[model samples]
Target: MARIAVIGAGMGAMAAAARLAVAGHRVTVYERSATYGGALGAFERDGFVFDTGPGLLHLPAVWRDLFLKTGKEPLERCVGLTEVDPASRHLFADGSAVTLPNASRAGIVSALESALGAGAGERWGDFLGRARDAWDRSRRPLLEEPLWDDWQVLGRDPYPALRQRRMLRTRQAATVTEVGALELADPRLAALFEGCALAYGLDPRRAPASAALLPYMEQTFGSWYVAGGMRELARAVYERCLARKVEFGFGSEVTSIVVRDGRAAGVELAGGAVAEADHVVAGADTALAAGQELWEDGDVRPQGGPDAGQLPGRFAVLLGLSGARPASAVHRSVVHSPDTGAEAAAVFGGRLAERPTVTVLRPDDPRIRPDDAHEAVTLTATVTGHGGAVDWRDKALRERCAEALIDAAGTAVEDLRARALWHEILTPAETGAVPAPSLAGLGGRYLHPANSTRLPGLHLVGGHAHPGGGLAHAGMSGALVAGLIVEGADFRGSQ
Candidate 1:
């Protein structure tokens, strides 16, 4: 069996390590932090806990498959998986509200109709049909398979075009913004559609019409929450790795991927000790890996897209409330910005939004808090990542944003600020992690780098690699990398 040295203990890296270990390869993981999970992290104090990264997961089948393939225990047994019904409650600028059912198309349509107006349900349902077409057309090429060598083929827009009514008129909705304006035809609905893309750090106006698939995927697959917190899911994956006898080196930072004779030899740790291996898998950011001389000149590069500096970052607030968990509280709520256009411009323009859109998560799960008398609330927004445009370190600035979010929460949590016993803030500065590149336009440019690098035994996996970010996509990245390394470059995809 080949010896494999994997960098970083992120979910994707750990997932790959677990699979490779189960496949009989000797695997060792080197983590810079003392713990695993990377962004799948959590914060706790005074017995109240809050998720530091993504609060909900979509397309759980990815990790479910990971668990099934790597061990006898199913994912459901490893962690308490709960479907978050009424997946999300949206509070629009017009004082309108809607509760969308989990993965139920009909229920979502009915809710939209009841809240928005007559015929609104039909419009959304019809839009979902178009979105489904996009999803079906691009699902395999974009997610299931390793990125093609000639990835340009995947760039072609998969969104089916609407038949033009006027003679000789051939204009088509090419961007998500166009899809919203031409198809949805309501500002509130447009906000709802764009909000989904924004949640993924995508700019709807620039993102291809295929991005409609974002909402489609969520509405179809349903969003789920672990009973305790998302951290438990990571913990379970880490435990799976341990069960497979995969050795872990915590607080061990890798300085570079050692290369010899045009192939991956192993990794060089910060302390100068070298772990020689037949292959190296990088679960960290591609740019950082490259900077460490993991890939030589002309080895490989991303197809196209803006620099990492242009990507948006996440800013968050963790509130420790001094009140009983409200019985009627929904799992998640989104307060759409009053002016989405302005907010989008600020985020994509690398400026902080004066009134940013906010997503509030108040899990009813008891494990996140000390007792029945306290609630742990998490508030997050996608903002400018580079250039220090948003000073998260400024206590006054974080407080101002927190106050605004509390106001936006409205009835979601009655008198949110008044119930706060303590609060914590996490900025991109603190996270200090690279944002995943956006999948913009139909051009192949947005496609992340492939798993197989020019180096013979070096592989890339994680949010920064092919198929891109989010919990499910990162897991998919790991599967793709492991498949490529185990089944050879000719491997089509996971079974």
Candidate 2:
């Protein structure tokens, strides 16, 4: 059995720890906080509970597979899982809205036709068809496996953008923005298409058309909500790791990864104590692992493009409402900004939009509320934070941003201000920005570093690593890292 030291008690780290332990490796997880679940955090006050991280789960089969691999009990047995019907309701700035049915293309197409116009749904459906093609082409290399050494091949966009002929000039939609305008046509439909990209902090103007896979995955797999809170998913994974005999050191922060003979020796703690291991898996930021130099020279380092440093911190505003959730409420809704272009510019420019696109999540779970008379809701928007340009620490600034979210969310929740008993704002200061899942285009700028780094015994996993972010992709990150470690780098994921 090999002694493996995993950094951070995040979901990805714990997933790797569990799988490694099940493979007979002695795994120890080191987290700086007093708890597990890096980005998966929760807030509770009185009887209200809220997920500070991702509020919904998509492609839950990933976690289901993890649970099955780690133990006999499946994911459903560990946590209360329910499919969110009407996957999401989209409110365009044009005052037109459409409620998308869960996992039913026909239903969604019909709904869009009713809400937008005769050919609107057909156009959106056509786009989804192309998006599905993109998903099929890139699913293997971009996800479900280790990022290849020749990842540059993925730099070529997989999205089969339609060739449009205008007079003598032949035009093909290259970026997501062009796809929305030249293909989707209607401004409302365009916002819905680009809104999916914007939610991940990807600027629609620059994000490659392959980013269409974001909504494709969601529509195909459907959205799911965990009972209690999303934090429960973290708890279940942490418990699974424990059951697999993976040890955890909660309050133990890794200062550096000790190197011996140019391979990963182990980890050095905050107080200079070393925990030696045969291999090291970094499920957190590798920059801080060894003075921001661990990935220098010939290593597959983190990308720092125009949207760099880190993806925009998921700016969340948790609301504690006094009224009971309406019986007709959908699980989630996206309130598009009046001007998405300006909104993207503001986020990338280190500012907040006057009317930003806001995603409102109101799960129909009693575990999150004190009683049927009360409700807990979360509103999220993507904004720049990695750079020091935006000061999130300022209370006044946070409140101003929170107010903007509340105002923007008014479309989804009636009398939102009056119904609120209290509110909590999570800025970049508390949660830090989250990386989106790797996209298959933009000259591979959207792809994450390979899980197998140039550092021999050191591996990178989690949202910031291969397969990239999002709950499902993070699970894949853990799996890929474990496969590489256990199978000696020849592992190419499930055949």
Query: Highest TM-score, which number?
Result: 2
> On residues 1-495, what C-alpha lDDT tens digit does candidate 2 reach at each position?
999999988888888999999999999999998999988899999888999898999989889999999889999999999999989999987788999999998889999999999999999899999999999998988887787776778889999999999999989988888999889998998898778888876888888999989988889889898999889999999999999999989899898888888788899999899999999999876764564345545444677532664467778898989888999998899999988889888887778788888999998888989999998999999887745688888888889989999988998999999999989889888888767778887777888888887778888888888888788888888988899999985797844
- Give the residue spans of candidate 2 off by over 4 A: 288-300, 305-310
Question: Number of clashes in every candidate structure?
Answer: 0, 1
State TM-scores per candidate. 0.95, 0.97
User: By lDDT, who's the top model here?
Assistant: 2
Kindly report which residue stretches of model 1 are placed more than 4 angstroms away from their true locations once superposed: 163-169, 287-300, 303-309, 388-391, 433-441
Candidate 2: give the clashing pairs.
313-433
> Candidate 1, residues 1-495: lDDT per residue as tens digits?
999999999988998999999989999999988999988899999999889988998999999999999999999999999999979999888889899999999999999999899989999999999989988888887888887766767678887756544567756888778877778889889888888888787777777878778899899999999978999999999999999999999999888788778788998888799999998999865553453444345333553233334667788889999988878888999999987778878887767677778999999988999999999999888877645556567778667766766667755678887898988888777775444433534665557777887778889888778888788888988888888888995799876
Model 2 Cα shift for residue 252 (angstroms)? 0.5
Q: Native-vs-model 1 lDDT?
A: 0.82
After TM-score superposition, the amount by which residue 148's alpha carbon in candidate 2 deviates from its true location, in angstroms, is: 1.0
